[model samples]
Target: MLQNNSELKSKIDQLWNKFWSGGISNPLTAIEQITYLLFMKRLDELDQKRKADAEWTGENYTSKFEGQWIPPEYRNQSEPEKFAIDKRTLRWSEFKRMQAEEMLQHVQGKVFPFLKDLNGAESNFTHHMKNAVFIIPKAALLVEAVKTIDDIFAVMEKDSQEKGQAFQDIQGDVYEFLLSEIATAGKNGQFRTPRHIIKLMADLVQPQLGHRIADPACGTGGFLLGAYQYIITELAKKAGAKDLAPDEDGFIRTSVAASLTEKAQAILQQSLYGYDIDATMVRLGLMNLMMHGIDEPNIDYQDTLSKSYSEESAYDVVLANPPFTGSIDKGDINEALQLSTTKTELLFVENIYRLLKKGGTACVIVPQGVLFSSGKAFKDLRQILVERCDLKAIITLPSGVFKPYAGVSTAILLFTKVWGAKDKITKPATENVWFYEMVADGYSLDDKRNKQQGYGDLQDIINQYHARDAATDTDRTAKYFMVPRSEIADEKNNFDLSLSRYKTDVFEEVHYDAPDVILDRLIQAEVGNLDEAELAKLQSGIVRDLLDLKGMLG
Candidate 1:
């Protein structure tokens, strides 16, 4: 969505430059700091709107800024009331009116502390905010940032009204744009999954309302947010709302406000959960969900692969693009994960399998190597998917799908747990496995990833996957086909799930002259057997080419 709006894109670029020029060079740190400012602004605006709503309905409403608040650091003073400041003064709307120096001091000394404690001690956002620091170094820089953010919001509001897009969605896109500036990869091969790819996985998984959804290595909660948006869009369609439109990636989209009923709001508060080893990611992810109207996101700072994480078989839907880090410390590996290898890609897939409840579904992205590797662990993982679970589909993505961050060929695994069986397969659940080789993903395959004219195979993948028929989709020569489990599980195949293993390539037929005829033609040319007129024409052509070259050089 932000891609189509050059104005918004420019504004985001300007904001990024402001942060960089204003002493914040690290992309992650700059984004986190920017998130805090946005939250502060959004908090005040939302509170004001709620107040107006309460007054309109003649209801009792308590605003977050309704009373005086004491900074936690000053609470132990003998005369604590002397240190108290009016909560109203700490709001973005109020502080933004101050002089640059005063505003900087107010935000650093008073407003940030208030925001950190805004959700109270029990909230996960607050838990993650404990170590967060207000690090904008100068007053002029703070003033410029606030002005740029205001301009951005104004443009977002205008875009929302003019284009019938959601303001919240645009705001979310702004954050996503900010995140795209983090050019460097994180520890353990972690990087943000492209939002469109996440949307594709969400559609295949079809996370339902009230279904506990999770991402074990959710960097910035893209998968969880994708599922949430999908659920909201589905709800809007069910409600018969007519404002729904397809996003840039061709997925149906609607304003969260369209179907955000009280029940959905309540159910959503508990539905999406995520974990990441990076605390910064956890914080940014929580804020990301909150920015999109999820009041209390469950992203936290814990490595799911660690032995300490004990929640197994707890989620109903798992959508993840776990880091492709090759290996993890063997000692830190979770015991419940039955995979014996320390290969992070394999172990995380197993961890996802364990995280799903009986009959639960998981859509995960893994490097293509995991599909056809000859290693025993790779074969064993594929065996569990085919024999113990209802292995649904394997979609091979082009290697360039992750360009600029990685060029590793990857595939999506869509499967469901069956009867909660473990260790041994009581019965083989997969009769056939669906495979699709996606050649393009609606963007140029280069590092820039410029948007192309049409979405290539994205809409087709969704439509075909939902309408896939095992009986009729048997053409091995087509882009999509079904492969029998027996073929995949055969000893010769070694449980290889690579799409190429079953796909048949059809080469076009060509006719050529017999070898003797071609050889005679070659000899005729080499031996100068042509007529005098033909030889004269060839000599003239060579002379003309030489003249042209000499003329160009001169």
Candidate 2:
């Protein structure tokens, strides 16, 4: 829906520029401030919707806004003073009607504290909200932002109704578009993966309900959210719902709450998890999942590749695009990772492998260097994947996939852990590894990343992966093919997983005119106005030059 909503995009742009001009120049900070405002507005909207539903169905539902306020300063005061101020005034609906200055004071003084105390003192939201500050700085900017957000939501509501889309889907799109703005600003080493690529990875993994899905270096929780949406869509299909329709961006938006039973929804909420080193990213990731109906998102602020994290073999499915350009402190590296390297990319890959339970699958993106680097650390890691696990597929992505932020070529590695009994080393279970060369991902490979119709290979890659046949499908020249493990283990290849190493070029031959015939044609074309004697002289001179050149060569 965001693809077709020009007005919405304009409004968001206006809001972003307002923040920039209003002295909030940092993109992440600006986005956080906007997120807090949007959350406030959405909280009131959701409460009202629930109240109406409860009234219609005669169900008992308590609204979070239906309470009284006793400020910490007045808690020990007289009863009259303690009960004097109504907590309802802190609600967005009530305060939005007040004067701009009054609204700002009320939100900064009361509403933010109220949010920090939501769910309980132990809730993740409250824990993260403890450090949240309202930095809008002026009543006028806050008012303008609130108005623009209202208009944005209005457009989203209309689009959702017309397209049968979940409102959360539209909200997620709005958040993603905002994040893409961050990518466009040239924030090095910190960029959200495109949604279509996330969806493709989710489909390849095929996550199901009750499966613990995690992203160790989740940026805004895109991959985990994709897996959540995929599971919900599959549940809908199984329940006989209509086909999930694709939006203009080619993403299928489905209402998980409407399609899934309460139990299934609970399982889904508990199954999704994420971690990020940046506290701001953790907060945004939490808000991202919570806005999508995951009541309690399990996202935390922790460097997952550090020694402090000990959650090995705890997740059933691991999906991540971890930071690929940094190295960790040698003292901070986890002892559990046997790979000898501080490269975050290689260490994160090993960490992902360690985090998976036996038989658990993982789909991760890494730099192209990880596939075929001749370094001992790189080759050792590749051997661990090829010999110790069921290394499934190697998908080489274009260098421009993360363009404008990083042009480092990347690839997706799909494998499953297979630990032997008694901790003995196990033989490689991989007979053949599927390889896919993704030339286009539905978008141009430039900084603009404009969508190109009928050019993306995502769906075709997914299809060929599922229908892959090792015995009969032996064309190495095709985009999709398989290579045997024995060939991968050959000393000459050094277990190189790059597709180009195994792919063979098919040469086509062409015929050309003889040199004498070509020279005769050229002479005829140039000697049209020359006399016979002149033409003969020209031919004799050409022959004499040719003879001299041939003698010199000899």
Candidate 3:
């Protein structure tokens, strides 16, 4: 959507350049600072909206900004001597109108502390807000950033209204676009998944409202948000709302609040969760979910593959594109994961399996080498998927899916945990595994990833997945088909899951001219000075001979 608004992008780019020029060069930190400002603005707007609604409806409503405040200098003084400042002055709407220097000082002195204390000590925002620092360094930079953000939000409001999208939906898009900027800024191993691919995975998983969903390596919480949006859209449709409408890039924008009952919304909010190793990413993920209307997203800073994480068999649906190019220390790896290596990819895959409850399902992305690598850890992980769970689908993605950061080929592994009575791991329920080779994902595979029309396979993959039949999908030459588990278990295959391993290429036979005919044509053309017509005929004969040879080779 940002691609459709060049002016909006130019404003954002100017904002980023201002940050770099203002001394905050770290992309992650820049994003965090921007997030704080956006949060401040949204908080004031939310309070204002609630207050107006309460006045109109004659309902008792408490505003977050309606409270007394203590000045910093008087806080340590005796109660009688201490002076108080109105909390209303700390509101973003009020402080943003102050002079540049005064505004910077007030935000650092009062507003940030207020943000830290928001909700309560137990809220996710409060927990992550503990270490938040405003380091813009210059009031001019802050003022410029604030103005740019105001413009950004204004454009977002107009765009959302014109497109019949919720403000929160546009907010999510804005956050995603910012995240993509971070990815392009060269944050190592932190590329956010393309929105279209996230939607495709969400559709394949078809997460329900009550289902518990999680992402272990949730960079910016894209997959978790995708699942949340899908669930919301389905709920809306069930409530007689129109089917989700796609935007220019094929993303469906829907209002979750319009469809679900209060109780259902509360449950939906708690049903989504995420975990990440990076503290900065955890903060971003939480903010990303919060901006999209999730009041209390369960995102935390925890290495799911490390011993510090202990929530086994907890989630119902696990969706992730875990980091593939790193490995953890052997001693720090969780004891619950039985993999023999410290490879983060393998451990994260196994960790996802462990995190699933009985009958739980997961759709995860892994490097392509995981499909056919002869490494013991690789083969062992595949064995577990094939023998212990219902291996549903192996969708191979193009190598450039994570372009500019990583061109490593990857695939989505969809499987369900099978536990017998007493939660014992049982034999797999898999009979056949569906394989889909995605050559394009609606965007060019290049680093730019510009949108392209009629080149993506995501929707077709989703549609064919629901209608797939092992009996009818027997054409190995096609992009979508099923391969029986027996064939996958063949000794020569070594449990290879790559589509190329099972797919049969159709080669056509051809015939060619004899070598003598080609040699004679060449000699005739090069021999004595012949008439122009004779030479022309000989040239034509030589071309025919070459064509015949090429056809035979084909």
- For model 2, residues 1-554, the per-residue Cα lDDT tens digits are 45568888898999999999989998888998998888788888888887898899798999878867555455676674744456677677788887899888988888877766666668988897778888889898888888889899999998878878878888888988887776333343555788888888888999999999999998788998899988888888888887577755565557456657779988998998899887888888888887777878999888988889998888889999988768889999988888889898899888888888898999999889999888999999998888878999999999888876777899999999886322667467677899999998877899777767753888888888999899866899999898999999998897999999999899999998876666556555657688888877876786556545545645
Q: Mark the regions of model 1 whose C-alpha exceeds 4 Å error after superposition.
A: 57-59, 76-79, 419-424, 511-554
In order, the Cα lDDT scores of the candidates are 0.86, 0.83, 0.82
Q: What ranking of all candidate models by TM-score puts the best one first?
A: 1, 2, 3
Model 3, 418-525: lDDT tens digits are 852234554456789999998888878888878787638877888889999999999999998999998888898878898999888989899877776765565655
Residue 384 in candidate 1, Cα distance off native in Å: 0.9
Selected candidate, larger TM-score, 1 vs 2:
1
Candidate 2 has an lDDT of: 0.83
The regions of model 3 sitting more than 4 angstroms off are 70-84, 183-188, 249-251, 420-427, 508-554
At residue 145, give the lDDT of candidate 3: 87
Model 1 lDDT tens row, 1-554: 77688998998899889888888999878888998999888888778877997899797989999788987777788999988889889878889999999999989988998888888878888899999999999999999999988899999999999988888788878888888888666446676788889888888888889999999998888888999988988888888878677878888865465346778889988999999988888888998888777878989899899999999889999999898856889999988887789999999999898999988999999989999998889988998899889999999999888878878889999999885534456669899899999999999998888888788889999999999999999999999999989988887887899888888999999999865565555545543676777767765765445445545645
TM-scores for candidates 1 onward, in order: 0.91, 0.89, 0.88
Q: Which one is best on TM-score?
A: 1
Candidate 2 local Cα displacement, residue 518, angstroms? 11
